[model samples]
Target: MSLDLTLCPDCGAPAEVEWRAVMESTDGPVEHARVRCLRGHWYLLPVASLAGPGCRLAQSPTSFRE
Candidate 1:
């Protein structure tokens, strides 16, 4: 099955996500993504996958941390 793209659970809006940077953390390179909803709900997604853009995964409702 084709994997579904990342979407805002609050408004069901498609997440406008892009890689911001790779910070050096204790775990290693922490991939960061900037996501914003149509309603201007900004969010930062901390993930490990850096395959490429347009890659998104389901995030928790409270995943919008800073």
Candidate 2:
């Protein structure tokens, strides 16, 4: 999986793109990426929406606590 760098929508920190794939959804094939921030915040973002203007993480993020 190729890694891409993006800003964490929640923390505004650097995030790492874990992987991307096209999934079968009700609408159609939607591309998504799993990203993790330096603060261990995880988010699943739609690839297309990332390019749109004023894209922000309005949804709550997922965090795995150890």
Candidate 3:
């Protein structure tokens, strides 16, 4: 299965790759996300699914927004 991470908002690099693994937010499960690039750079993204269109990171830091 292909990872659904977003592009880096700073470097335009696509995060969430295979083998490297994905992580969720620890800030309490936000609708958005923060992922790492191939170069190991981290960035913000929308919470997408690993199963389908609307999923989330398996186990990473999450932030809940109000």
Candidate that would win on TM-score: 2
Comparing 1 and 3 on TM-score, the stronger one:
1
Every candidate's lDDT: 0.55, 0.67, 0.46
lDDT of 3 by residue, 18-54 (tens): 2332455675554555567667886444445222333
Residue 25 miss distance in model 3 (angstroms): 13
lDDT of 2 by residue, 1-66 (tens): 434666676877757778898999999899998888889998898876452334332221222221
- What are the TM-scores, per candidate, against the unseen true structure? 0.51, 0.66, 0.38
Worst 10 residues of 3 by lDDT: 57-66
lDDT of 1 at 42: 65
Q: Between prediction 2 and prediction 3, which has the larger lDDT?
A: 2
Q: Who wins the lDDT comparison?
A: 2
Cand. 2 Cα-lDDT: 0.67
CA shift of 13, model 1, Å: 1.5
Ranked by TM-score, top first: 2, 1, 3
Give lDDT tens digits, candidate 1, residues 1-66: 332246654676656564476777887788677767668776676754422344233544333443
Give candidate 1 misplaced runs (Cα > 4 Å): 1-5, 48-66
RMSD of each: 9.7, 8.7, 11.8
Candidate order (lDDT): 2, 1, 3
